[model samples]
Target: MTKDTRKTEYGNESISSLKGADRVRLRPGVIFGSDGLDGCQHSFFEILSNSIDEAREGHGNVIEVTRFTDHSIMVQDWGRGLPVDYNTKEERYNWELVYCELYAGGKYQNNSGENYEYSLGLNGLGACATQYSSEYFDVTVFRDGYKYRLHFEKGENIGGLSKEKCKYEQTSTIQKWKPDIQVFTDISIPLEYFQTVLKKQAVVNAGLRFILKDEESGETFVYCYENGIVDYIKEITREDGFTEIQFYETSTKGRDREDKPEYKVKMQIAFCFNNHTNLLEYYHNSSFLEYGGAPDKAVKNALVYEIDKCIKNRGKYNKDEAKITFADIEDSLILVVNSFSTVTSYENQTKKSITNRFIQEAMTDFLKQQLEIYFIENKIESDKIVEQILVNKRSRETAEKTRINIKKKLSGSVDISNRVKKFVDCRTKDLLKREIYI
Candidate 1:
């Protein structure tokens, strides 16, 4: 096979063999699910996820994504970069293969540990897929106290894993990729989506700093949260659980993995009830797992059972106004449950779901016991929390009923907007002409 004139690697493969046009032309919709804001959003998210992985490993926090006028993009992270080591025999590439080949990555291999105990990029397709979809790709890695660089042009690595011997008196290397305009279709990424991505990342992972700069627009947004979930709780509930629980934190093993060489569970849970009717539960990891799972469910159940038992046995218990369900307490109470386990994977290579169901169950039981003790010991403070939960339960119920009523009222309406008739009769007919709301 004839190699492309660019820096060719030792592989007996040709870029022409990959069928770039044939693969993308017929199935363009696959890489980018749709041709709209969603597809545009995915373009940036794919890169952001890479940065988030670095944050997960405690390697680096600050990630910068810059935009260009012609739609080229650059994403740089100060985290531990993609590893590179020649396969002593194949004389091929290491990290370079990761960029070009399908399902080749440390995250999915189950070989990495520590913060990477779980892999976010499941199927190991994240790198290869993104590279395949883009016009070309470039990667600069700073690892093992050395800096190396590789460039892939048109879904082919021009040169495989070229170490920059003369460059980088600094440790960080640069990665620049020009996205395939044919797939993206005349779009510069929206700033709002980028902000949302960075904000979510900062909230889930503490001490992570992300910066997004639009080179042409001369705009840069920075997100960094040092206090982690505590700050996140404060942002949502406007109440700090720690201010009342003070020096108390209850923890349990949230995930167990014998295969992992070393494993640990660091979980801190605190919650305070407020007068608001809504329930807000914040369960997060360094950069992923916002959705609650068995672990979080287990924890909530324990708290509810403990409160109920306390009220039943002891007559002077708090929450006499309303019987609080675990559901009830979740509302109006700001709960921050964070677990950083030395072992990441509960079971799957994706590491999105936790496998150890018993961990959540164990935590639930432990928290229930301790919550009972804390309540008995601190009557005034604990009772205040109890009363707050009752208030939330009542309000949450009312809110749900109100929503049902509203939906019923709008049953016959064609538009869900508040002013259906007025909206329909607006001066010039132009939802089509309406400014880009989407």
Candidate 2:
């Protein structure tokens, strides 16, 4: 065999590392999970999450989001402005850390409640990652009775941090950035995404006001839920639910394992049985849990157990009937769960779900106890809930049976004697001669 001319030398120089902005700009998918519109949308969420965390800490009550005609997005919060000055311990300017460095943030020590007890921007990568992925980013912070400003382009700081004295009453932080088209294939985030996200934040945060301004459409909208998920449920059911809404909330401390450090978790649940509408939403640390790993499992287990027990005790089930499933309860149930924990185990950077064993156990036990007490205190409401769930279960079973029978009949060999109406059979086996009629 001839010597291989194509064989290239493999040496230490072959290994390389991405630094600073290149880490996110070169591989946007690695950080944001996509290089498409989804990633672009997530970048927007990162900035909004920071604002939400600040507001949750009682630093602010209102957050304003603006979508300019040029597609640049701005998030303004009336909170204690971000720290951008020099850090004595880190020996670096916070502006550089927050706007340029990845994995440098204030939330890393959240478990100790040093900065925040519960927060949405737990990864410490949102601010920097978004900045790196943006074409141009600008930050204006009002704190310490002064104004601080920073600007960046393509992940590189410009003119450094600017400080000036200003007569401002409330401390605030305003960020404006345009998602880079080079980094993200598409950055045209729709207006509906902002509306939906702001609404969700308002629902989970309670009493927090979100103002959305759309420059393209010249429209402004506000979203706030004074009673959080409970008010949201009322809005969805419109007083037409078969049973009255029930709200339960509790706080507890626990750990995933014996050796793990203990942490606090706060859980809120609001639900009602409605024949005409149904919804199930789970949120952890103000981030919407689309997959709902822990909370979903807990909700399913507790609701099914309590409802099934109620059915058996009330003689609502037929003899030898199968137990009720979560689907049965879910069919007529409209529930919203908002939970917060000092330590959260997000499955990934996208934060669509959480997998905290302690949170799951705490929620399941609390929900079971609250449901048991509710059933005992409100007999009529519990009866209505049980009856509706049974009706849904029966309806679903009947539908499944009908579907199976139809599928079986359709799968059978074609018989001219029992031909379907208006369906004519072709006489020839030739491919070109076969025809179908409507």
Candidate 3:
């Protein structure tokens, strides 16, 4: 055996910790989930999420976003500007904790209702991580009758904190940053992303207004929804729905487990059945759940159970017919669920889904009860829903059968009698030696 001198020694000194900006700069994917354009987009959303959280807490009603031709982005919110002064408890500058330290923010004690009742940027890593991954970051906060400013270049603070008396009566926070090319492979987020996200935010935030400005095109777009999801549903269906839209909302408190702390959940649901159009969207804490987890399961379970019961009781199904599935209902149903919880278990930092057991249980139970009441009170609508769902089910079944028949015909064994045009086959039976040419 030969001792290899080329190998590096494994010792205590070899273990090193990433600190400050390096924590996010060195491993951008660990925090933002990507080191490419997606990560840059996530960084933008992080800052936007903070503004959204503040607005949701009733501190603001408007958020402004600007896209510069230089690829820098800015978010301004009329919220209680972030506390960037001093912190007596932590004995550190609030600016340091907010911009320089990860895992530090006011949203951590949400269950206590001290800071935010429901928050989107709950991880506390958004501000610091975004700052660390930016080529240059700037923050301007107006609060406490003073204007506070902080600047960072390449994740390092430039002039610490700049404070001066403010003349404006309204308090606000403005953040501007350019994602660093060094940190991300690409940072050129498109304007369409901003428009879509801002529209979604406006839809979920109800009366809140989002203003987007494109520097390159010199165009400004505004988005606002007075009635939130219900209005959005109407816009999508154009009031051509077969049934009138229904809206239901409720609040509850519970814990995922006996040992877990209890938290509050607020849910709003709007839905209608349309033969020509269909949509289903789920949002949690104002963040769009692209891959809904708890809410999706709850909706599927509750709707299927209730609708199936209604169908069976009304004799809408044919003899020996199977119960309708969610897909059948989905083909003609338009629903939007906006839910917020004091405690959330997001699948990841992206917040595309949630896995809270209590949330699923609560939503499932609440939806079932609402659907039961709705079905009983509106017999005509219930009948129409069942009829439409049945049509969709039968149509899907027919399509499946047709697809299977087509697949069978196409997959039939091709022999000399059924040889396809321009096709050749090998004579050797051995699989290794066989060859088929097109």
Candidate 2 lDDT over 55-165, as tens digits, reads 999999999999998889999999999999999999999998888888889998888989988999987899999999999999999999889999999999999989999
RMSD of each: 12.3, 5.3, 4.5
lDDT agreement of model 2 with the native: 0.93
Greater lDDT among 1 and 2 belongs to: 2
- lDDT per residue, candidate 3, 166-268, as tens digits? 7887999999999999999999999999999999989999999999999999999999999999999999999679999999999999999999999999999
Model 2, C-alpha of 220: deviation from truth (Å): 0.8
Candidate 1 residue-wise lDDT, 177-251, digit = tens: 776766666456666767876886786677888888877679888888787666755666564342252323444
Runs of candidate 1 exceeding 4 Å displacement: 1-43, 55-58, 69-72, 89-91, 108-123, 142-148, 159-162, 178-188, 237-264, 276-285, 314-323, 342-355, 394-438
Separate clash counts for every candidate: 3, 0, 0
Off by over 4 Å in 3: 1-5, 416-438
Which run of 10 residues does model 2 get worst, by summed lDDT? Answer: 416-425
lDDT of 1 at 414: 41
